[model samples]
Target: MIKVLIADDQELIRQSLQIVLNSRQDMTVTDVAADGQEVIRCVRKNVPDVILMDVRMPKMDGVQCTKIIKESYPQIKIIILTTFDDDEYVYNALKYGASGYMLKGVSMDELVGAITTVYNGWAMINPDIAAKVLRFFSQMAQADDTISVREKDMEELTRTEWKIIAQVEKGASNKEIAKNLNLSEGTVRNYLSTILNKLDLRDRTQLAIWAVQTNVRKRVET
Candidate 1:
């Protein structure tokens, strides 16, 4: 079962998430916290597999909480739940190793799917905010022209892997990539894993940034 910790200042939101998540047979709401400090306490007592973190909580905010938790318990996956307007917070959360980001208005089904996806070691970004994330990374990549792509790294990837990277740069999900490439989802995931390892990237977010930096997507498109 995937253990979950919900951290939100709003009691209604916390209780609602607890009820909805606990109803799932595959997941359990292990604990709830009203602030970042309590979240740290709860985590120390019983580490959860996933944390649904609210961005604007009193005391310490979710971004700082994410940084702290990930620094100590790197295995714990965190999904930042916030409004779309909190673009800076979302970017910082991702930089601090948050595994996923979801808008607070996401449906229970989408939340559950995101939780499962992150628990399985994949990153998830809500579609609505994906473009913003891409833009943020693209700008960052442009600012850091020193970030070089070694010729050897380009030569190391197979043609199929390059295609997968192109799809990822376009913000295609694993399922979408699989369908587009006529491959199974599992195969696509495996390819992603291999690609990350070969490129020394931490996750798909970094890979996407690298793709933009290297003009891999543009090259493939043309």
Candidate 2:
């Protein structure tokens, strides 16, 4: 069973998601929270496998909550449930390690499928907002060319690491990356960490943005 947590400031959304998600055979709502702080509390106690988080909860907001949850529970996957207008929040949420985001208008089946997908360690982007999300990532790529990062860092990555980075650019998680590169998830994680350290990037989101800007796969081909 995929243990799930629902966090939305609106009571109706929290209840609606809980009722619908619990009816699914493969999922159970372990906790429901009405704010970001409560979301943290529930997660600390229950340690759910997947979290459906609202983007604008009071007290902490989904972006900060996602960051804290990921920092404390790297194994837990979060799906930001939003109304699909907060571009900055969406970018930061994904940057902080959310597996993906879904508009609240998504059909229950889609939401359920997303839970299963993230539980399987894959990112789940809603097609409705994919273009907007990609634009946000592209902005991240172009918005700060003057940032302190050194371009020479790419030269330090091994070909295997380049392959892993290519997967990240496609929003593939460690499990998907491992399958793509014929390596274990542990090996992918290790390589990813090394790559991040070498590039001085913050997380997979940044690495993915860099990959898009640089097309690191070409390095592997060369």
Indicate which candidate wins on lDDT: 1
TM, every model: 0.92, 0.71
lDDT of all predictions:
0.89, 0.82
Q: With candidate 2 superimposed using the best TM-score fit, by how many Å does residue 116's alpha carbon deviate from the native? A: 0.6
lDDT of 2 by residue, 1-222 (tens): 999999988888888888998898888999999888999999989999999988998889999999999999999999998875787898899877898789988898888888987787666777667667767777777776422458587678777777888777666756678887889988877787798899997555566677777756576668
Question: What CA RMSD would candidate 2 show?
Answer: 5.4
lDDT, candidate 1, at 32: 99
Q: Taking the tens digit of each residue's C-alpha lDDT, what string does model 1 give over 134-212?
A: 7877877768432455678778999899999999887788888999999999999999999988877778877877887
Q: Candidate 1 at residue 38, lDDT?
A: 97
TM-score top scorer: 1
Model 2 lDDT-worst window of ten: 142-151
